[model samples]
Target: MKASAAMRTALQRQWQEGGWLSWLLFPFSLLAAAAVAAKRLAYRAGWRRAERVGVPVVVVGNLYVGGTGKTPFIVAAAHALRERGHRPGIVSRGYGAAIGPVPRVGCGTLDPAVFGDEPALIARQAGVPVAVHPRRAEAARTLLHQHPDVDVILSDDGLQHLALARDVEIVVQDERGIGNGLLLPAGPLREPASRLRGVDAVVTNRSGGRDGTLPTPPAGVRAVDMDLVIDSVWRLADGERRPLPALPAARRIAAVAGIGNPARFFATLRRAGIRLDATVGLPDHYDYAHSPFAAIEADLILVTDKDAVKCPAPDDPRVWAVSVSAHLSDPTFFDWLETRLHGRTPA
Candidate 1:
């Protein structure tokens, strides 16, 4: 069932409060959890073989079913890998896109609607080869075949897809850490919190917070803190770029975030010292074909880079996109990630 605005807000509250509604749905969570465990066990017991696509695969995913800065993290990680002498290509499920048998995504190829917003945005921002298919393994293979020099495969949100064997797994979490701690239809988690213990690394995207430290992870698991640096805002009309401070103080603003955690986006704007008259949290990967901006009272509209890609050039010049980049606190995570991707320990 599509979550209503009230339901989405209630779920967000439940993540923090663990209210009665979450308790009421707990029975179903158990059934969902058991099924999830059995599927993983099948892969572990060799009942299902994980397909390896010749190159090392690094998966960036989240245990919770929402945005956890995976898009920005992958863009940052991909460039960092490139700097360390590895070519990275991306593979995604291309949710909400109509990717046919030919699933390759690049310049002069599929439109955002046809290729999916995330895949299209990744290709545009990362400037690397990307492919989208419901079957990620097929996407990865097609991506590799097209970009043969690609040394590493970065799987976007493929932790549950055990069909694709991965050498390194990095699970990212945002401010809404394991809300309600229950399985889908009840709470936010796709896997149990204990799943953190098995992954190679856990990254906390504390971009919304002011403090230096990330929220603590489970016991025995080392956590890396990441910040999303809001670099600039670009005019959606003429592609005119301006520093964040360039936002006109005269106009009232509305921060519109269609991401998994819209509050985080609003917090980002607040941290940037831009006070919003209104904050709108649309569903994740919201199609902006019919924008809600018309009803918004604010004179200016600000959106995330992800939303910016899907939103067509607004007729109004007041609309702008805030572009952000991920900054990981621990340099060692990359070194560790590099070693795992190469399957070699540094001398």
Candidate 2:
């Protein structure tokens, strides 16, 4: 991992538990919490009006700051909505990218660096048009203008972005389930645990382990589990689909992930019975401007679908990308979600 990634990983470790470092940072978290509360109050009091893009918006986001598998859930939701006869388009803030206010539409052929890693992954996997901008509401407007057939918009990571008015709000959580329950600089949350109470639904993701049970939801909060099952594996050098077991019985096999939760990818591979020689976790949205595993002696380097977009095609053939599909614990979850879109059903 790069130096910046290492430092971030270290901080995330501190966020999972209370320590002197977290306590020292607790005062700063209060300042952030106060700012968030104030902004929310402004919106709630009508001091600031949220803009709508003339389409029903469904925002899928997390309170854990990052991870929690929001991108996979977005892709899954888009596919499910299409099957239910609703045309869906996706909008994102294009975080970690230098894109300006102007919206950038995305496709599988788009450059991940120019757009965003998550957007690129959604475009490639979900087969939906994606519009990215700093302001998600603007992206939604641009997406609707470009794809007039779309009657519903999915906002990737827009729970905190109150500028975009959403008809349905869904918060995705992982096994950690609000560690230490503190706000930023102290814990992982962008919003407090109370935020989940207002969301249309809460989704607990089994991103790290397949058989692993989901984190228990807070009392009175209804939550559902989401399983991300590995659907297939694709070779990076060439877009060839191969089963996990088919990956050459090489002498040394390793995995490297730059997503929010690298351990999830590692476990998915292990569950598939792939023996890994080593595992490397980098910061989320790790740009593959240069291959970090270039010098590794492994015969194959396993990567996740999100990280694969950055390495759509790598010079080295050892790199491979694993694809996963989000499966809700209960099929009825889609029934509930579809009900939310009923009023905005496409004419």
Candidate 3:
């Protein structure tokens, strides 16, 4: 379910400052936590069988509901795995797609509306085979069957989806951490904070702020820091590239983001030294087929790469897409990931 602005604001407040709303919703959160715990227990107890794919699987996910930079990390990890001599494939839930059993995603393969924007973006950026289905395990199998050369599979945002067994589990966290460290309805987390204890690695994603702390992981779990790097901005109309800071400062820039966390997008622009005269925040995975740009008043428009996929080539030339890359502060995490995947240290 998409979050409304009121719901978003209330949840954000709960994350920053706990109030009566969280306490009022605390009972429902308990129900959510109980259900989540029960499902996990069923999988662990083998009450429900977790199927394993032919190839190793790595899951990059977050406990909270909003954007924790999973898509960028998946794209970066897929490329990194390829560089290490392993063919990688990605699978996603296709949150906004209207698909059947399984649809393979690639550049020009399927419309973003049919395969979801994030999946389309990953396929385009990573140049790897991607498959989307509500059942992510089935999607992984479809990707592997279609691209037999893929030695590893990366499941994007499937931490709570226990049906898909994983060899490596990476939990991503924003600077907000767990957001009151409570479950759904009361807070932002889908699962409990204890879930981090079992993840293979915990990545703290920082977009703007300096505070990089998160709940400590279990003894053996590795924690890493990541920053979203906006390398360049490209105009969607003609694919013209310009350095982010090099954009003409005279024009009024209006940033539009339909992502999980619109604030992060805005913060990225501000950090890049662009003053936003106006900002439009839409629900995560918002369909831009309606085109919000018609009403926005500004000299130029800036959008996230996620939003760029769904937007039609604008009749207006002022529209530009921000291209971001995931930069891990700790390069050792990649080495550790590679070693875990292959069961041997990289030479």
- Each prediction's TM-score against the native? 0.94, 0.93, 0.94
Backbone collision tally, model 2: 0
Candidate 3: Cα lDDT at 240: 88
lDDT of each: 0.84, 0.83, 0.84
Residues 1-347, candidate 1: write the lDDT tens digits.
23577778877788656888888888999999999999999998999999999999998999879898999999988888998998989999998887788766564334678788888888888878888998888888888888899999999999988899998888999867776677876788898888888887888888877443334676655578888988999988888998998876646888888888888899888887888888888999999877777787877899998888878656878789999998889877777788776678632
Residue pairs whose backbone atoms clash in candidate 2 = none
So what's the TM-score on candidate 3? 0.94
Q: Report the CA-based lDDT of candidate 3 relative to the real structure.
A: 0.84
Model 3, 175-206: lDDT tens digits are 88887887888888899888888888888778
**Backbone clashes per model, in order?**
0, 0, 0
Task: State the displacement of the C-alpha of residue 225, model 2, in Å, after optimal TM-score superposition.
Answer: 0.7
| Preferred candidate (lDDT higher): 1 or 3 | 3
Ranking 2 against 3 by TM-score, winner: 3
Error of 2 at 321 (Å): 0.7
Worst 10 residues of 2 by lDDT: 209-218
Assess the local accuracy of residue 138 in candidate 1 as a C-alpha lDDT between 0 and 100.
86
lDDT of 2 at 135: 88
**lDDT (Cα) of model 1:** 0.84
User: Which parts of model 1 are misplaced by more than 4 Å?
Assistant: 1-3, 107-110, 210-220
